[model samples]
Target: MAIDLEIWWLRCLSFIIVIPFLGPHLVAIWKMLKDLLFFMVIIAIVMIGYGVASRSMVYYPTVNNFTTEAGGSIDNSFDGRSVFRQIIYPVYYFLYGDFSDELANLDSNPDAGWSIADHVLLAVHMLFVNILLFNLLIAMFTKRYEKVHQETRTIWHSQQYLFTREYFTRSPFLPPISLIYDIYCLIRMFVFFIRRNYFETPVYQHTRVFKIIPKKRDTIKEWHNFEDAYTYEYAHDEVKALKTASMKSKSGSDSDNKDDTTTDDNDLNNTTNGLKQVQRSLTRLERIVEELNVQLEGAIEKKQNPTTP
Candidate 1:
């Protein structure tokens, strides 16, 4: 089959132009569909299983037998041999909070009434379908919706960038001009690719703002050397300051010690002065005692030699 290049080209152009506007909404829809697909798979499997179980165990024997006995063929209309009618519809009804009429009929009729197994099966089905699966699907959809809604701006901007890039690369909307422009672009790209280094280098080196910035070419060893140099300088200054402080402290302590020694010498001189004063007082008292003894001796001499009186 011959392909319509024009149709495809127009579609591509339209997609590029329109998608930027509706990107977020379209993305949200897509995400919702994806989440719902998984949710649906789980629900379908569980529902189908219950449906098959109920049909085989409960319906086939009771409803089918009843229809057969009521002047009907073996393949009765009420038999519900189709999976859609039997399993899907029943599960759908159960999930949507409409208790099945067939179940109600079976419950009312004592002959075709639910047995213990049937009751248990219905209870379990209701628990999963009505209580669990339904709520889970709602929660999953709500979470996905909120996520898509929250990230709408980011998604839209990213998609806009892509669209704008495509639009610029492509030709104008006019057929003749667009074709000419496309051909030109194609030739330009081919030439650019062939001589990539020649064309690309100038654009990259001169036109690009990012390329103007200097890139660091330091190796691990160089980085380590820089760190070591910084650390050594810092440590050297710190050690110099510490040594100066230590020397100052030593000089101050030596001066304090000299002052202490001077104070001790003064205290010793005062003690020596006090001792000399006590010695002088003792010497004067001894002289007085000696003088009194001399006077008594003279009196005794006078008594013995009394002829002059």
Candidate 2:
């Protein structure tokens, strides 16, 4: 009853954890599909054992054990065997007949008929499953142990004595094998200096090599206002000054034209008035000269009469 209850509890508990994490864990396992194949084969063996075990424990758990891929009908189960034989003894009997004499009591079963062939198959399955299990465990855990051990050894050896590398150079016509190490050192030094020079150069001066982004603090104010560059450079004050200068030049030209027109009109009026006065004075002089000529003729006649007397 305790075993049965435990089995039921484990089945239920697996769902509680597995239902949530099963997908991710399965993805992880699926990524390493080759490794998972070994686990799959072992699981298949365990499931087969379980099915036969169920037949013995509970009556007639489904008897379908044929796999299409393996292309062989596995003599998967037998009846009338003891509890140990139905569950576990068949596995040992198949793997090592070394256990056949030890667990012979398990062979007397009420199946189609228990045969030597069936025992050998069960033993082979068990051996394969066990080997798979051992190898998988080593692969998953062995590397971790090796890494820790290696680090400890390195520390111990490094503490005992300092390693002094004596570097030498090679020239042309020399055996390269003797100078391979020196060449490697030179290559490493070249790479180091190149990297150092690249990083130490000012990023602003060599913008093509690398772009230097201004910090958030520098860009934040400009971004918030979003000022137009053209608007800032060409202000209202500058435009207004240009317009005022243009208007003043036009006004000056108009004033000069008006003054010249007024002077021409004044000159024409003075010339017309002076021509009228000169005509009136010439007529008056003509009248005075006619009167003087008449007086002179009268005096000449009187003088001729006085001379005859």
Candidate 3:
């Protein structure tokens, strides 16, 4: 009994192990299956119609050839007793390039009651199933894959959140012991329900308002961080642009040294001073932005979670 229990537990664990790996991809797989279901409906209609028609064409021809014992060899691939083997399987297999035998039978016994209609039907069936329907299915799959690829990161994060919440909320105990935890929860819920309905002031009637406030604060902090980073990048780009302009001015001044060397030297000094001033202004602006960010964060913290006294 212990061995049996162990085997069962192991199997359960194996299944559980696959959840994390398959969780993110489950949505994409579901979408693909939905598309495939629609495609299958169309395929079913076409296959059944063609199968019945093809089978009817060959049904009398094969029967007569069999009884008369004609010199031509019989094609039994689509001459089975059951509808499945005679029609459905033959047509389905034909989609996968199994047409040589059927074609050969037609060629070898041209006078065996086979006509242009049979050949035309076979051509039409292959054109629809192999070329049209199959390609359409492939295109549908590709479109679904592209959509899933675009949202892969979002899907992964959502799946991770669900996994995290599941593990955090679930009982820590395994299997048999977890059943005990479940019963404990059931009783707690029943008691809580009774208290809430019967008592004026239920002990478990605490609001979840406090829990949500912290999440709001965290979101605000993230936005503030993003703003600060953007400000810094903009300042950095401005500084780079000023430096490039200064370099170009200095190069131009150097190139014009033939006409008034003294003037070129003075112009270079002016450009250098202008660049230094721009850098200082940028540094001061960055300092102000940082100070403002700190003050804003402090104000938000005070507003969200004010000190009791």
Cα lDDT tens digits for candidate 3, 153-234: 7776666665566667788999999999999989988888788788844465453231222346578667667876886687
TM-score of each: 0.43, 0.21, 0.51
Residue 190 alpha-carbon offset, candidate 2, angstroms: 60
- RMSD after Cα superposition, model 3: 16.4
The C-alpha lDDT values of all candidates are 0.64, 0.47, 0.71
Off by over 4 Å in 1: 1-25, 62-64, 67-81, 110-116, 162-309
Residue 29, candidate 1: C-alpha displacement in angstroms: 2.7
Number of the top TM-score candidate: 3
Task: At residue 120, give the lDDT of candidate 1.
Answer: 76
Weakest 10 consecutive residues, lDDT, candidate 3? Answer: 205-214
User: Candidate 3 lDDT (Cα, whole model)?
Assistant: 0.71
lDDT of 1 by residue, 1-309 (tens): 136876776465436434645677666767788888998898888888887787676656554454556665333355546657666786777776787475665566555444456777888988877888778878987888788778877888777766666656555668877888778768876676667676554332222122111223244335445655665566556556555655555555555777765665565565456546544644574566456445645555666667664
